[model samples]
Target: MLKRVFQALSGARPGEQLPVLLSFMALLCLLLSYYLVKPLRDSMFLSYYQASDLAYMAIVVTVSSLVVIKFFNHWVGRIPRYRLMSITYAVMMICKLLFLLILPISGRWGTVVFYLWASVYFTLVLSILWGVINTIFSARQAERSFGFVALGATLGNISGAKLSAWLAGSAFKDWALLLSIGAMSAALGLILLAVQIASRDPETARKQSGTAALHVSRGMQDIVSLFGNGYVRGIALMVFTLALISMAVQFQAYGQIDRNTAATVYGEEFAWFDPPGQHFEVIYGLKKLDAAAQQARLKALGRSGNLPTAQIQELSQSFGRYQKQFESRTRKVLSDVYAYQGLLGVFLLVVVARFLFRFVGLRYTVLILPAFYALAAMVLMFPLEIALIQVLLVIGGALNYSLNNATKELLYTPTSEAVRFQLKPLIEGPVMRLGDVTASLLQIGISTALALWLALTEMSQGRLLLALGLLFIAAWMLAIWATGRRYDQAQQADPPRQELDLHA
Candidate 1:
């Protein structure tokens, strides 16, 4: 029964089952670790900074991603695939451990650093994992198996988010980081096991080790040359557009969450207090303030004269509780949102993705994301409640992780090893971040212009985003259609050549 289920889900042959299952479990652990810390990262960052600050942080992330990708590209051919994976995992573990130790003392600065690190970690590590999987499985196998493999990641996402929510709400929230570290360790072990199994097969062995013999240029020239391949350019465009859409949507969703949390904790008139100003310190530092000090600070800030002394005392006493409540609530909201996304992802990957891949074919499968984005944008054009926005986020995230992700990874199966290791990372890492940067700049520009000209708030920028999203969706659709044609042509030209040996 187990074998039948695996075969049905992944189309894995008898000999391929072990590697496929191992890869599944490996990815499960990888994503579990990530999702475990994701809620904490978002909550902590939002606690210290405004939702708008995400755009500035995105710029930092994109720059750091470029540097990291360049560094990783430099060693792609110089290091063995397995050793590189091991080393990357080890380094990440060390960094995460360090982050855990210093997070308490680091304050907002530590939150910023961790947010940036986690962003880079997700893209870089996942890129490497997919690259390794590409080498292990042939293109044909990948189409059938990748969705099933992604099911593990979907499950991990659900498990991690749910666990994080529970832990955050409980007294054991402090242990979440340690658990994430342990998940990473488990992922490393599973990845090594998968690689060892794949090494037993001659074709897989050659594919895995073939990059070592190729010459990799030590400069930007190699990366630049990748653009000469129209397919690579198409993939890059798709990724860029997708990232832009994702980020824009995320910005709106996060803004809503921030507003909702503030309203819930401090009431709808909380904005009048201007918590980002000196009152921020007063509110957060309430624990250290006695009633007299609190009244003094509020009086100095011209905020206490309107309220009665009893109400003032009550508010001051509850201010510390409200701060904690805000953080806790934010964490729970994030975790719940992610958990819903993961659940939807699992359902789509298990029930929808395979059917689509098997029947709809790769070309059309690539079109689903843009269509969904277009629909989502249309829905967001109207003023909706926070629940509606969360629904959109959950759907968008689910589609991206399940159908979109599997299809995107499958696109690289026919590419060369250099493309997988070097060019692919450039596309998935820095290029995607570039898309994020684009979205951020656009949002900043729109918000600034609206504030200056029409005296509109940031929340009013959704109409412009809807228009921009349509434009991007059109470009995304075109890129997918063009890239799909290229993919089909490449497959026909060399059906047996799973990994095209394009010497860099």
Candidate 2:
């Protein structure tokens, strides 16, 4: 029964199941560890920096990724695979612990460093982890097992997001402790992964014995060599385009989060729930009133009775003066709510991805991902209620975890192992980060151009964001088409060993 289930899930034979399971667990722990602190990272960055500055921060991440990857290459050659993996895990834990200490004392500067560190850790750690997986399995084994192993990442995302949300809601909401928990989880997972690698594949230890260090100079050469290859360039472009849309969607979600927090902050001071003339006397009055119930409260507050201009002005001034104390609580609640909803979306990805991969080929199923972004952008481009905006963001995020992540990994299978080892890091790291930088610059440029037009001609930022989203989505679609075509050609030229019949 276990063999049958493993066959259905990963197309792996009974002999391969243990290694696949180990790979899955390793990824699950790694992603969960990162995501545990992810919400806090988002909140911190937005709190300290403007939304527009995200692009600039992404550029920093790009540079940091390059540096780390170079460092990774150097170490991979000198250390045993298991020992290096252990060291990698230890370094990540130390960084997380340091972040816990710094977050309390260093203020915004800590946030800035945390943001950069998290980006580097996320990029480098995942790259190294995947590289390890590739090293352990033959290309044929990877083709069969990677899809199932990749599911662990999705599961990890859900587990971590849910854990973080729960912590956020709890009274003893010490972020420092939460981060410590995540770091520890990562360490435990990595240690187990090391044991599994050492025990199962002693040959890997032999391969690592005397490999030369990957020099920093060679990193740039690897990147340049990739762009020079048409096939690799196509893969890079696909990643680049997808990254643009993903980052843009994230930016908008952050925008929504910021807007929600701002509303919560000033909801007491401003008549946000009702028309300008009709105001709730207290926060409870606003909080308790459902749409239908609000009418009765408005009437009780003398909605029909015209207040003098001076009284209205005084009421507005008095509002939020005492209520400022509660703003932290409100923001925390809002952030947690969104975080929970995001967790739900990730959970949904687990279900949706299984169905897609089962029924549709990897090549075709991923095409659906860009459609999700397109539809989301089209719907959200116009004026939308906050509730609807949150819903759309959830849907987009679900699609991201479901199709985007899995499909991207599968694309690597048709390529040579050298490409898988060297070029993939370049693609996933710098090229992907380059896309983010492009998106960020574009976002800033479009917003600035629109703002100037708005001063002269009354265009809204919402419509501008939507327009930019559509533009990027179009590019994303083209990229999907191009990459899909190229991938099909590549597969036909060099088919996967033990390839499952898509029709079956």
Candidate 3:
């Protein structure tokens, strides 16, 4: 019975009736958005925010939807099909304008605010968009075509990132607002989608339309109950772990690139340190004294009266020179890292991702990514090339993402109809965001402390980096073990429980 139910869900029109236009529109909107966001983000169109703000926005949406605003979702579902989709798309348009234009113009909101706007728009609309698709397509179609649908988004992402890269450091920087206008292009595609969907034939017109809709329809209540157990918790935690690795790896890649590439652009070492003006003031951080103070501090290095006056002066000059060299090298390394991991990485990510999910299942497959990440970090520590870190980022930037996203959807498979739609945001969005925030907090703190430690101590540079790498590896392995053990029991079949296993 369950098998038959899934069969009914696999096609746009029960595999009998095809959507001539709506399908195309859906694919178009997804691709357009995917292609634009990357470049917009990396561009000077709105240079004020970081990725965390985006995560925060998503969290806010999820929390609101889960508690105070959940009713809105039902209201959306309650609408007549035509009107329902119209409203969501209309909302999407409003939100997109706000996302693309507002921040670039106002320029007053702090980085956090900017981040929030990006995040909120991304989560709300994207979530709604998918929800609409889920409602429209049969369950089996939901599973298979969802990836194809997502592929549109994926292509958009790659295109956007490439565009941003191609335009980097160009005279077009001043025309950011004009560039912002490009996002409005989504409107055109969306409008096209509406028309196509409106024109598509209704299910009654198709053969086999009377087939069973799907299996194991349950309400949100039972889904919540399932999540209350350890197995579910383990699965959720797997997602959380994956997100952290992705984030940390990105940062690591960025830092490395900035460090290595600074040399090529600004000249050897200390090139990234900037014009040497601010010695005490930090931006988005702490304030310090000016360059004179910095120079004084450098001068004072030999004030311990251990070395001769001539030696001290020589050492100070040499130290400054060394610093500049370091910065230069750092910048070159980082920029290259970004180009490699952030750009070329998409296909690689998809390939490995599909392979793992196809063969290993979401649960077991998820674990292997971190091990790879740990290994990558370990390898980079040995030589510390910026490019190597970018490669590690494949695991760091994409691993958690690839694994967590797959796991969340997998985890929801056996859910009843109501629960599948209703609770997806809470479990996948808010919790996911919270995990991101916490991981960012931990990573920022650890990175800072390590920076300070590295600054003050005289430890071997290679050894210090290696030690940090080891620490991350240890943490990852520990999480993998614990999560596996917790969910171990769920893997086995039980009488009624088998019916509810996410594997289904």
Candidate 4:
């Protein structure tokens, strides 16, 4: 039944089945992890630690992830992609065991530690896994199959988004139950990865590495070489743009989100739900309430639209007033209680985003990620007046995860087989996941700066988020553009004529 379902859905090719099957299976694991754990993030840890502290943990983990990638990239090339993947999973299994037993019993700090490891660890594995895929396939096949891969993640994402709310509403309100579910989902992904590797023929595996070679570090060489070589650098730049705009996109989207998110009661503001004028207030905050306004905006867009997130971020130069807009709204929002307003709104916004993926093609979708971010910023920063920053941020997060998954799949295609096994994981798992860790630390460092200055003057922290997000995005755009330019220039050949024509 499952095979039939996949066969029916997978387009472009009927002969190739296994990779599609594995991607879908992996996506299931991803979705399961997302749905089971996301809801409890606040309950488990945010209540205990400052977002800044959490960010620091991420930074630490990213650095460690980098090390893991280095280990894989330098050595894995000596072996087969599938076998190396199995080795990586074995390490993860050990970590999972330790995480399941040690952290659960260890309490708060333990959980936080595990969160960092869990967050950074999986992506580290995936990067190498993809590097392997890039080595094995042609560019065109990668493109066609990407959606299938994304479909798995999308299904997983939507399910996860719904699960958070669904579990809460149903009898499964227990945090322990949610945590258990999360473990199962994550474990499921690991198992699927194992299965994908295990399915490889024994004869094929032995041919590549009758003997296993030790892995070593090229030690920033890959990254440095990435910069030095024009083509590699281009891909890196594109990846960077994806990362940077992803930040700005979160804030911008949040700003627009406020136009729709009606205020609800929680904490000291509990009495305001019954108040007059609340409904009318945010609608106008949207800054584009008329049907004409929305149509005008949509009409201005191509399938992906014109103004990428990198460009829209330029508005921040308007006195830092619009930039401050992000912070003020965030502060206003934090004043709301989590149950009615924060959690509910964030939930709907992210789920809606899942479906939007189908509307855009992968390359164009990624190329313009920066612009979408800018749109989100315009809405949050200027319109709904930044009140719904969290909602927008969540939207951005979903986009970041989904869009990049598509882009990276393409990148992996052109790489050589050995490089894919060795370097790919480093790229996917550590390098990519490391970005999250970096963002967390960045948030903390900026927050600390604000705290120090708050006594002397009002430090605009919300704008601070917007600024960091924009900076990352802008730099990313420039890099990706440069990469694209080089790729377009990859040695095009003069036509090859028949030998008979030359003889004639």
**Top-TM-score structure, candidate number:** 1
- Worst 10-residue lDDT window for candidate 3 reads 279-288
Question: Using Cα atoms with residue i matched to residue i, what is each candidate's TM-score against the true structure?
Answer: 0.90, 0.74, 0.58, 0.62
Tell me the lDDT of model 1 at 177. 80
* Candidate 3 wrongly placed segments (more than 4 Å): 1-28, 31-35, 38-89, 95-105, 108-111, 133-147, 167-226, 229-235, 258-363, 377-383, 395-414, 444-504
Instruction: Compare the candidates by lDDT and give the number of the best one.
Output: 1
Model 1 lDDT tens row, 89-165: 88999998899899988876688899999889888888988888887887777767888888888888888999999
Order of all candidates by TM-score, from best down to worst? Answer: 1, 2, 4, 3
User: Who is ahead in TM-score, 1 or 4?
Assistant: 1
- Give per-residue CA lDDT, model 3, range 1-504, as digits (tens): 643553333222344223312443454344445434433443221223332233344445344534422443455335543464456556655655565556545542433354444444455445444444444443333334333344334444444444444444354533332343344345344544644553353532221243223232234553465366554455455545545545544444544443333324333322233345242112211102334554566556446536577866765565455433433333233333344443433453344444444445444654666677566655655556654455566445443333334334434433333434444444455554655555565554444676577573322333344445456555655654554443333333352121143333
After TM-score superposition, the amount by which residue 144's alpha carbon in candidate 2 deviates from its true location, in angstroms, is: 4.4
For model 3, the local distance difference test gives 0.43
- Report the lDDT of model 3 for residue 392: 63
Whole-model lDDT per candidate = 0.80, 0.61, 0.43, 0.47
Per-residue lDDT for 352-376 in model 2, tens only? 5555544555557657867877787
Instruction: Quote the positional error of residue 208 for candidate 2 in Å.
Output: 12
Better of 1 and 2 by lDDT: 1
- Model 4 residue 114 CA deviation in Å: 1.3
TM-score of 3: 0.58
